[model samples]
Target: MHHEAFVTATFKNLKPNDVEFRMSRSSPGRYALHEFMKNVYDLKVTDGNGNALDVSRPDPYSWKVNHHDGTIKVSYILFGNMGDGTYSQIDETHAHLNMPATFMYMPNLQNQGIEVTFNVRDDLKWKVATQLKHVDGNTYYAKDLQYFMDSPTEISNYSVRSFDVDGQTINFVLHHNGTEAELDAYFEKVKKIVLQEQKVYGELPSYDYGTYTFLACYVLNASGDGMEHRNSTIITSTTSLANGGMDGNIGTVAHEFFHCWNVERIRPQSLEPFKFDQVNMSGELWFAEGFTSYFDDLSLCRAGLISQEAYIKGLIGTFNYVWNSPGRQFFNPIEMSYQAPFVDAARSVDPVNRVNTFVSYYSYGSMLGLALDLSLRENGLNLDDFMKMMWTRFGKHEQPYTVTDLHNTLNAYAGKDFGDYFFNHYIYKNEMPDMKRLLNNVGVSLTQDQNNVSFGATIVHGIISQNTIMGSSAYKAGLDNGDKIIKIGDTVINDSVDVNSIWNTYQPNDQVPIVFERFGKTQETTVVLQASNVYNLSLFETNNLALDKKKQKMRDAWLQTKK
Candidate 1:
């Protein structure tokens, strides 16, 4: 990968001479402030006649151009190596362009239309795939800067498989070194996901220009990310279709596809105008992102691309994470959502206590979605009806919604008392729902693992890694992160053998002497063990528990195809 791009922008008919052109610090679908200007250098500004124009930097991100004519052209070298939803990557394989990280704009000219012509590398044989309206062969038009920033462009020697659905074109552009058959197989599943998500909302959003595009780069150089936009989505992964990605990458496809109706159009009022100068935070990400996470796998299940058992098993990871975390004592779903700026793919070098303090809104909200789905099913209704109601109230006309609006909509769909109780206990506070009873209602079982014991922390090569769980026996023994467990209960730690097997030799509530090293100092303590809180899920039939046919019918309706 070359990892660099030559960018140019021309602003004509300027009303002011001292115009400010700057790089955005944030991008669509991201909440962190990126120092995009750090990757920008070799900048040169000129007039219409190709004369040099004087420019001054008032801040690190913005450049002020004074004593200029009505027109000024800005060109620079943009270095991008990270290929994901939030950042751009230019390489010999492809140019994965995320606009805020790639382009510079005139802040004052927010309403001005944009015409971009990508100069494709002829030797690379690159072509353009973007949601922007095509003007000519390589040129495209954006009605405004918002649309332009939202439209991510993928230019590479890529293969495309397109289909027509509901009078709209859906394009899947793949840049992978895979066979044509692999692309066809993957695209087939992609098509099924599209239709199934449409069934959730009862219809597809009216995509601009009658088109929606999925710009996918499944190559070795790209990062694994899936970001949603207005009429398009960018899904990048390092795994190719043949290398476990055929099944692994479909969940991202389903998730981002659901966003076209949920977060993309069924919008959050706080995130309506995404500011690029600083971090943008919203309390409603539990709904915008969490609910989408909940539906990602469910949509695939409804599409018949995955089995019900597979879907049920898939919930185990996220469900356990949310249900077992102690972070809920500090924040509700909304408060945890506001922490996106620090946690959403953004982290600091210094060590922090997110292990004890944070729970991902994605997992938390997915479990909540699961709870709501089953709770509604108990009342002879379903989440689809609530979502369809939300779609009509907030999505169809593109009206953004607040927390009260969501509560009111739920009230209108389910009931006032039901909505208030759910909001008060689950959204405002941190109490979990009757997940055990709810799952049992649909013939699913939730039980803690009998053989599992709490080791407090994950271990790697005789060293204690990650934050030890609070109130765990290991914590009571004063073991912490970075402690090297030289011996556990008189068993010498060995690099070759599995340490977990040695730990499993001892049962829960047993106490033994432990030796560890921290900061190069050896220490000794007697540690008491505790049972792990981790749980398991299985169908009643799988567990040999008697299940009535009515519960089977309920399970079928929950996971079966809606269309």
Candidate 2:
């Protein structure tokens, strides 16, 4: 055994029998910094003389460092499990192993690189897969230690398939299992969409580009996440074959992959030189995530995977979300993006006020992206040219931009003073943005139909005041803080409700009569079910216009078609 800060171990004993090792923890957060949690254990089984033998780290539940020892055997647990809260679950028995702790960095030191290798028991049934490169046999190599640490839970279960894209191999590591045929079909669809995105972006310049998909069972209950790196991106979701269709899945892949150009390469000021120890904020998160999120869905639409109506419906969903959020008033996208680390903590209670007051850079940022795109389009400069200019000016430099730098860079690209408007409307004010005027030039119109009045209400698990979003359709419909939805149409809701079964039964612009009660008074209201968060618009629901326009603009830009 070698005693070191990283906790490396060498096994001297050798045995032919099977052995299992358990670590006190499975993440770096629980251990000392400067040490990767996955590297905390190593085993090499030898004869009585301690010669050479094979070693392996098998299974997701625990890292089993294996080797052939003599009559005796020796193994140590590499990392301990952080427990079951933050991770997702495939079944009741198996949960997605999240390694948030692994993102911990050593104080005041830059990590040039780190290596984590894993080998499993040959006969083990547990499937082994990751975003890392697969070496021969059971071994795998995580290329960038900083990135691996940034997203330790970035890996997924072994229920996905592997395919090739543009001479580079690709793998879809999923949290949920689908049949081999099903997975193969999905991978093919994803490959085609990604290839199309690469063509639009000119070329896939990075030496490596990786993709990961997480299947969330309850379509809306799960959220989507994406972060870019030099050669890969960590995308987390509950998206599956069942909920998101070909367009949704492939579009998500393209969006994150495109970040290799937009966000990953020509990055914002705060995100470029990422401070591992603190919250990294940039007023430009809207460009980073919003633009990416907008493109993710739009790329597919441009590829003809979805119709114009479907695309519009999706945008409407996102707009409704953004328009209805009270949090937008509390914190602007810039502050929210900067305070992501603390705001994401469990203590964040108010929908608006976080443990740290922060908004999702993706959600609010995307809204700004929509506004920016429309502005560009109106001025006779399309997003494609803007993207090319940004790439040429900022992306080629391969460096981060500060707030002033972001404004100056955009000004240089657009040849105008564009920062003030974005700052005034998105960063400071809470007035409803006039999206109709923006989309007019692009031939899209926004309007309200009181006859098809949506009242823009949404449902919740309970009638708890805190659970009800302040500006949602439910709140706008005069539903009291403690009112409960006992029934939707003819269906009685119990044990949590099925929003889909109730909503999907109607058509767009269809009216649905809903009943809820408060203070012993049962009231019935006929709500015109305008386009809601439905599969008719795709499985995912959003509330950002920039995200919507970004999607549409990305589609148009990728296809080189005029709106």
Candidate 3:
């Protein structure tokens, strides 16, 4: 049987399943992005002998080609009785690809293959860029199936820029509507942070650690946020660029870029093989997203983008964000990532309840990461050493690392039962982390009081548990992780609620009555707030000012900074 391939993709005003196609084979294949385009994309084929062959929808997601002499009918159901919004083909103003037929892979009888590229429409609102080599006009080449699968070239009207950071080529793209200066500043600052991070690890990885940022402007309404990929990240927020905006997004960029070392390379076993068709579930997301979260602000501070005070403030922010959520009682980081599909879907339906049930792999993960680092320090090791060991053993690998790989490598690096230390808290336990104690060991104190019944515990939040402080008291109060604490006693809660709130209000010896809630469960507690032994963010500061400076010096050294 002679095998040949010819491919063409087009869109019409008609619904997706209405188009037609003629083929020389009994079956042809197709691939589509269901997330962006949802419809019954139908296809039919005929042989050269003028015979209509049997075509089965074995894989609805995959395209099929069939042998035929007559035209093969290929179409899909776009809009039903419900109107297809104004964003239809020809009628749409922007040049967004109606269908994601960007990369087509054709394999020979020998099991080898070639990738075919599509010429995306060039308009002012759109700019096309990809890792694929440009063959000529509208055509590009992918080295293999992997590249073809990963490459999504059409970044419609999203922010974009190209930069070279410390001889490492980098790209920064913002939402087109965002201010150019803002993006430029972010790129410059983050590049510096990446460079500083690399210096500590010794050598840099490959020069082509390509990075891109996509801002959705209004992600899922005003609920804009960001997520990371191997070489790119998607960030969206309502903060306009023209209004001198987007200070919050800076930490996000730092967090995502750092993933190049963690999840992208030095990853866990479950995450080694990415199952794009279904779920890429992992129990080690705490290590990936959590540690990345801890280091995100640290990287910024090390690069001098933020002051030490600001760095601690950032950590406090994470503490508050995580502690206020109520999901700790229902789920942990590992379980959350594993049940991501259901959890994410549930979030879309009932966001409040979702947070109550599901914990964030990133937030709790980072907390665990800090705990692990402190534990290592307690055991005579440090995070820097772990980072270097990870880089030397796993990160330098040409292929992806697995959970087993990460575990084995970490065990080898630490030379002990590090697994139990990590998995117990981050994966298995629904218990609160000893963040206050851990911070104290590192010379920072975490203190809290609601009423006469006062206690110190690591506080975190749940998705459905909104409105309150984050950390020990917040966690024990059965509150959601991202709760916004409104009022305490007679005072209204502002941006943050923690020991500092108590400090700013009542004197050290003053007894105060506190009222707070979890998922709107209002409770009252009376307790005497204690004067901090350590500075805020410092778990173990001295009773005097001079000793605090000495501890600060040590903290500076830990951050590899000049005192």
Per-candidate clash tally: 1, 26, 94
lDDT of each: 0.90, 0.51, 0.50
RMSD of each: 1.2, 10.6, 9.6
Candidate 3's C-alpha runs over 4 A off are 1-126, 154-167, 178-183, 207-225, 244-246, 320-326, 329-332, 345-353, 378-380, 402-404, 417-433, 452-550, 560-563
What C-alpha root-mean-square deviation, in Å, does candidate 3 show against the real structure?
Answer: 9.6
lDDT per residue for candidate 1 within 1-563, as digits (tens), equals 46889999999998755799999998888877777898999999998889999999899999998877789899999999998998999989888899999999998898889999999988999999999999999999999889999999999999999999879999899999999999999999999999988988888889999999999999998999999999999999999999899999999999999999999899999897988788778989899899999999999999999998889999999888998787998899999999999998886899988888899988888888999999999999999889999999999999999988989998888899999999999998999988899999999999997566787778899888888877888888889998998888768887986877876888888897989988989999988888878888988888899999899899999999886
TM-score of model number 1:
0.98
lDDT of 1: 0.90
> Which candidate ranks first by lDDT, i.e. highest?
1
Worst 10 residues of 3 by lDDT: 24-33
1-563 per-residue lDDT for model 3 (tens digits): 01111234331232223222221110000111123223223333344334555655444344444443334433333321111111112112222121222212222211233334543436444555554556776676655544444443433465666666545666665543555676676667766766766765665566333434332332222324444444544444555544534456567667767766776667666653443344455666677667888788777778887776566656775676566566677666667666544543222444444434666677777766777777676566777677777887877674556556666666787774775556554556766657765565556656554333322332333122343323334344544444444455566664454644444655555655556564566766654544433323533433232336644555655554422
* Best candidate (score: TM-score): 1
